[model samples]
Target: MTTTSGNTNPASVQLSAQAFRDVIGRFASGVTVITTCSGGRNFGTTASAVTSLTDDPPMLLICLNKSSTSAHAIRESGTFAVNVLAEDHVQLAGRFASKLPDKFEGMAFEKDGNGSPLLVGAIAHLVCSVSEQVEAGTHYVFLARVEDAVAYPGHPLAYFRGAFGRMQMAPDASVLREVRERIITTVNEVDQAIDLDRWAAELAVGVDLVHRALIALVSEGLVRREAGQFVIAPVPESIIFESYTAKLAIELGVAESTVGRVSQGQLTQLRQYMEATFEFIKDDRFTDPEAWIQANERFHEYMVELAGSKILLDTYRRLGLPGLNARTINRSTYATAELLNDHRKLVEAYENKDLGAVVEVLREHADRPRQLRARERELFGRA
Candidate 1:
């Protein structure tokens, strides 16, 4: 690589070691633990510098730091196993990466045909025999023929920008939902920094995913990142009031399109869902915020759902109005009469084909959350 700056004569700009590493680290790759047995002693080291060269002859290549003892062990043994790690094998990857004197101590593993440790729980294991070696600057490149390969059904662990993570074979949004659910049901005892690794293990996901979720939460006002650590933030009134106002905007537009157009059948569904919200606030259900939240969501969702676009309805749900209720509305003292009263007026307006009244009712309905939030603020002094 070469560089020229500010129209100067093209002079050689030697890439600094940090610059070289920073540029190369952007190319994400699956992590592997290379294992070999030299003189009847097991040796292993974590590697991301591996690739499939070709399948015509089952060839692959791996680059190892020339000074690595594991590389020397593979040279003496003439054979090695590439243990492609699974997303959950984070600790195992760390164990082999460290200079712990014995990476396989007190661990159970199966040996491949060539006597290399087939790390248990790896997503795949490829036993290979070194066929050729090439000297690369500061590293040794081994061209190998795979003697045996076994792949399991699992996601591969990934390395990128000097950090461990997981590769996505397909787009996944479950991590966002899982992290939100975790925060909703969980109560933090101490206001301390988040333990990203602990969250990953609990959620059975990569720490990278947990880290992404926490970073996103910072913008949502549900978490705060201070000095490289995360702490849960008090749920902000802005997200709450803004969410309800957003729903009102969508609902008002929906009301303009679907006032008298709503069929009797859809009206009945609206009534059923709306009335169910009252059911949850009844004596046996007053404490069940979850049930009330579901009923409330279905009631409002049906209104916009009448707009007849799955995409629009999906967009509405993504605003996550029910989720706001989940985060708030902690005690049974939550007064629903006023909110449900607005629902009744909304239904009456829709039945009568009164668009003006429908719009008026929605604007008023959205203020219910602000009222509740104000009451909450007065109770807790949360600013």
Candidate 2:
């Protein structure tokens, strides 16, 4: 291939190998271990440069470094199996990529139709016979005709930017947190029912993960399981009153503990969060209730963080006060201007290090949600 500069001579425009690898590393690829049996011994090496060439005759291609032992074995036997690694097979991928004398030592595998060793528990496997091999630079590009293929259900192992990783199917703590926050925001801020399947689809996570998160929320008293479906638990007037009461108690402690101790750095961070919240709330620019909920949470979380007590923060979080308040607020009835004004007062109180004023602002902030819930209860009667 000629460069765009019309340089047909390869030496005329030399590129550093590390630079080339770094650029191409941006293209993520699935991890695979190419295995072959020759002279009654199994040989394998981890590779990422594999692709399907066509479907008519089932052709695939794999590029192997010329110096690799697996490449020599494939040349000798003319057959190899491509074992696509799953997320759980990171150790196996490492073993194959190393210069271990026996890559498959004590490993469980089965022979394919072409007598090539296929790693057990791989996400997929492809048995192939080498149809053509062309030497290209320091690697050999082998064109193989697929003899057989098999696939199993699992997330694939991936390589990108010079590190091995996996596509996550099961929700991690971050995913669970996100799902939890969205559930509370939707149920309270948007005043909507929880839709498990819709949330799963929107978050690109398994339904099971969403179910697990809902179970956690249920334990936190933010949700309840009924008739094989998860829903927001009924908020009695007393419970709503108790929630705000708890918030005032907990947050007042936070403000008192952090009052004189808050550093300039913490204050600046809090100010930035308030600015973000103001920007979002201005002119009702935030169409999504979740965005507004997040900004509000950030502002409050910083206050709690400044309190510098893990036990206190944990206690506050376990109460699920934010979620409760979200459920209580009827956006249609509650004035955004009033809410913004509450936040403004709170920020000013913090800036002045006035503990009494901060406590007063938090009480008012806490009371609004209760009032909204009371209004809701008066109108709707009950859940």
Candidate 3:
């Protein structure tokens, strides 16, 4: 939208087109070229004005000039496919932007469920059914409901004004370590999503560091590369439970410190961990001893983080046998109701700040479970 009359405010002033272009070019945005075919004909063009609109009803918005032939076809047919371009598709980007009569000439592509033509080997692709078309000035903005999508692993292609750029991928170990350190700082210190460029600059590193970090995650199966975007793998419920139980055990010790000795800073961290662990799951009372074991694991993880004792956390981690056995027990045994009751008692003790109660509760919560399970097995004639 544009409103050009004159600068109305004392502080507001207009810049020349050259200066304006230079200023706007500083912004780096992902490049997406939308394509569609109806009645056996292909049409597409490069565009950068694309963004996510909503999640409830999977939507995205893209703007095109009303005069573009693709816009007419999209409006008439009510279907289009969005191809998210990677840095490697610079040639495709240039080819599509031209007024060539046969844009699809010798180009490889596939049709999705909606019968929409999608460019093959793209970073990612989405086939959508047009939902709404709004006329804004000289451009027609189309909001579409995503019908199907697929993504591949690679670096996203970026465009700034008229120039194309590729993401830096670092390979050096020291550079990667530095990048991770800066990433941690940004995540903890900032409330907003930290800009990757600014973060790298602050660390005196290149964008390669960020790229390498993503590559490492992808290689380890900790993340996925699709359509030129990096996606974090979902944490499994078992893992979540294990982490919580471990945290709770760590925090139990910290909670035992005298009231006055527990400084305001430590108290803040302790409460945060407790509240975070509490709200993680919808159900606090697990169904069985194994489920309880998982819950216990997650609960203790938060506790450990709040304990503020790196030595304790590291020493505990080094005892691989304990953790390995704990995990084995979680997957093999079915938890009983009594185990959950013990967990509730432990949390109550910690919340009350009763040092003796906390210690007693934790001891039983940890050691009594195996005892109870073994008693039940013996009674049932397992031995």
In terms of TM-score, the best-performing candidate is 1
Task: Please say which candidate is ahead in TM-score: 2 or 3.
Answer: 2
Instruction: Give the candidate number with the greatest lDDT.
Output: 1
Q: RMSD, each candidate, Å?
A: 9.3, 16.7, 19.6
Q: What do the candidate models score in CA lDDT, each in turn?
A: 0.82, 0.79, 0.64
Candidate 3 lDDT, tens digit per residue, 1-383? 21342666635666567766676777888887788776677789888888889977899999999878788878877898999998899989998888899888898888877666788878899888899999999999999998877899887899886799986554678665554333322212322333557656776777767667757645544346666655544323344344446644655556564423545665555454444334322332233434433445555554554556789766444333233333334323434555545556655555566677767766666555456456657766442
Candidate 2 regions exceeding 4 Å error are 1-13, 168-383
TM-score of 2: 0.50
Worst ten in a row by lDDT for model 3: 183-192
Indicate whether candidate 2 or candidate 3 has the larger lDDT: 2
Error of model 3, residue 205, in angstroms: 18
Pairs clashing in candidate 2?
Answer: 188-326, 188-327
lDDT of 2 by residue, 1-383 (tens): 43433567877866667767877898999999999999999899999999999998999999999999999999999999999999888888889999999888799999997678898899999999999999999999999999899999888998999998966444467667877656554453332357888888999988888877777667666577767778776554566677568867888888877886788888888888887777544442343455676787888777887878888788767657567545654334333455677888887888898989998889988887656446655766744
All candidates in order of lDDT, best leading: 1, 2, 3
lDDT of 1 by residue, 1-383 (tens): 34423434445555678877888898998899999999989999999889999898999999999989999998898899999999988898899889999889987789998889998888899999999999999999999999899999898898899888977543137897777646543444225677888999988989878887877677776778888998866557687788788888899889988999989999888888878777666532245777777888889998999999898898787777776677666545445577788899999898899999999989989997777657756875755
Please say which candidate is ahead in TM-score: 1 or 2.
Answer: 1
TM-score of each: 0.54, 0.50, 0.44
- TM-score of model 3 vs. true structure: 0.44
